[model samples]
Target chain A: MIEFTMPSLGADMESGTFVEWLVKPGDAVRRGQVVCVIETQKGAVEVEIWDEGVVERLVARPGDELPVGAVMAVLRGAAEPAGRADKPSPPAAERTPRASRPAKPQGGPPTTPAMPAAGRPRISPAARRRAVELGIDPATLVPSQPGAPLQLADVERAAAHPVAASTTRVAPSTSAEARKQAMREAIAAAMSRSNRDIPHYYLGTTLRLDAALDWLEAHNATRPLAERALLAALQLRAVALALRDVPALNGWYSEGAFLQAPDVRIAVATSLRGGGLVTPALRDVDQLSLPDLSGRLRDLLTRARGGQLRSSELSDATITVTNLGELGMESVFGVIYPPQVALVGFGRVVERPWVADGALVVARTVHASLAADHRATDGAVGARFLTRLAEYLEQPETLWKPES
Target chain B: METGKLNPGALRKILFDCIASVAPEADFEALRTDRPWREELEIDSFDFQNILIAVSKRLGIEVPESDYRKLATLDTFVRYLAERMGAAG
Candidate 1:
């Protein structure tokens, strides 16, 4: 009989859900056929069969969360004698609620394996417990030999024995440590390439936000209890509408040229409340109405705080917007998210001193800054784009009106 | 048990639900049985494993990773599993 254990789907995955099975017991399987689908931290994938066999039993079921390396099924040759129905069942001992485990005193050996005495390997119970904690398969821990009895000493010896220091390592570089290093390296490379290879230009402007702020306050006056921060929503909508006229800022430079996309995929840089940063994309922002944009922004913020966003939502942003208004900052020079050619920074909309028609005056104003990639864009182009965007922001009425 | 008895709709629903749970925002039609799961869902290595684990747990089946890397789509997943479990669909 061949034991079908939970395989590590990726370097970082420690456990997975048995979402569904494509096959049932007594089914004939051929080599290279997917027998089951497992849900890991990443996503869903179909797992295939190796040796042609008949699935002897079904082990896990939908919603069952099993640790990586746990045995979930058993496969035997087409004509092998059938084992008992409970043959592959995990021993009752393993079912002991984790809350009841005996506390270890100064790490004097680990807990025993949950399996019964009969099927237990020859290794010490303490070693079995330690192996479980380490997520190491005891069977695999012992060297593969025809009939050698496994022991704790053998496991310890194996642990002590290090790979030949001088021998060239032949294994693929995909271990957890290696993968983490690769991710960091990728981020570093992208940052350096963007900063060095992509010529960037910075432009700053301050615009009065009294009308927008007034609109937000009046709109929220009749809103539901849960509706607050309507001003940010309006600002985001304004920026989205502004991008429709400034199409050149809504794309990335790839393959030695700027690739203009049809819709503006704007990324909102949201800092999780006392947590990590997440940038969820609001696709085709130019098409969404003001109310729709407000609803989506609320939803995105909620999901970002709850840590519920999928992997795809976290990648591939053409442009990013960071609002420091909530943080009470007046202005900030934004750093460009890699592969994105531009980033917009917005500051608090506070009443500040200004001169109008050569007379000193106090007027409501919000500071804004735009960082553009100078590699594919020039000062003239950036100025024109910013000019069009500012015109939309200052007028505000024409932004919502559809072009006929 | 009789083989080839599982309804295609039932199986398809089960499969799609499993995928949607993991990637709620993914375009379902893009997750065609004809396309490889990775290409169809645009799943990376880590996400791929999580999906595999969910499939295994939900279906009461165990899929070895070495073998799973060979499957490309929904059809292959069913066909291979049918053969392995000694059933037909």
Candidate 2:
């Protein structure tokens, strides 16, 4: 039996409310299938199971609040025998509410057969108890809607002799305030942890954007508005390519060691519409073309705002990139999101006087800064990474033809 | 309504409307026509490209990439659009 636990979605996330379970007991689940949805302060994320198995039991029920690393479910691998499955798994105590024990059965081995051979209606523990209180068997209650699970209301309605008024909806304003508080706490914890643990070194450099801007303008002139690439995408590609040459700056520092990530996943810091920020990953960013990168960036921004991000996108970032240019800031030095060792920041592109080939000239420039974990790398390594990043930006044509 | 012969005020309104859509917080009336959009309005390249799209869509004229330099300022954009409309007509 494999234990499927609630994953730590990010450094800040400590606990989440179990919103819904997409699968029930006895269902054969494949690897990478979304098994449940958990609501966090950041948003609702569809959590996936990493192993193929038949769900033996759901340790935690919907609406239960669970801390990070709490076991959410138990699954029996396909190769496991069904005979020993009768042995009950331990109840998830952490998910239980403080005021009262849930109506669901807890402790000892499960009484009913876990994987019923016949089709059975899935009902919540509250619904089952309500059915019992009304002297009705829950199994006999047909779901109000086809394929819909029997909820507490269905059981209540069955007992109320068809005259049951719907329960008043809970006020969402309270939960909204609570969510905001939770988010503020989470950010505080994560940032505090980052500051306390990571010995950070800061480095900043200015890059002339003349070549990049020229190439972008020329490239965009030929394409439609939808296909035109954004300078943000170009900057991201340059950073990704630069990471290939300076691998030390492209991974996580954990357990007193630096582990380099296999792929370059750039975590983009996007501000949420509801007054917070989230950094979602753009997976395998080094391989994407400019247009593809732009499209992905757009999609990432949209999804981040809509609160539809996946668990992996939140957790799998190797390094982060934050661009304050849109806000017109000339420079930013960011705090490293722990586990991840480095953060790259971009500032506003502004016209400034420059000397080129012994002649004074006006040039557009952007300030780029790197904040890295000094424990994993020094100023020299970080400087090289920035230098390579500038080189890549200087030759924007190579970004289009990455292979060459 | 000859091709490219749009009224200057109407063209200015169209440009301001386009800018407003891209950067809603921008102060259109206070904008300096001689300054770069980035300097005057803090519009990034993406917003600039979107402005080009809006102009192309409203004016029904293609703003080629080579002519992006001509659309740098409000005055240059207005002149460029007027000239393009006249030439196309």
In model 2, which residue pairs have backbone atoms overlapping below 3 Å? A221-B65, B4-B85
Model 2 over residues B1-87: C-alpha lDDT tens digits? Answer: 224457877788888888876666678778788887765675655567667777778877777767777887898888888888777
Candidate 2: which stretches are off by over 4 Å? A24-28, A79-175, A402-404, B1-89
Docking quality (DockQ) of candidate 2: 0.28
Which lDDT tens digits does candidate 1 get at residues B3-48?
Answer: 3444556555665666765566667665567766664454433344
Q: Highest DockQ among the candidates is held by which one?
A: 2
Each model's DockQ?
Answer: 0.01, 0.28
Candidate 1's C-alpha lDDT?
0.56
Model 2 Cα lDDT, one tens digit per residue, A173-241: 224455566667767777888889999999999999999999988877777776777788988999999
Q: What is residue A182's positional error in candidate 2, in angstroms?
A: 2.3
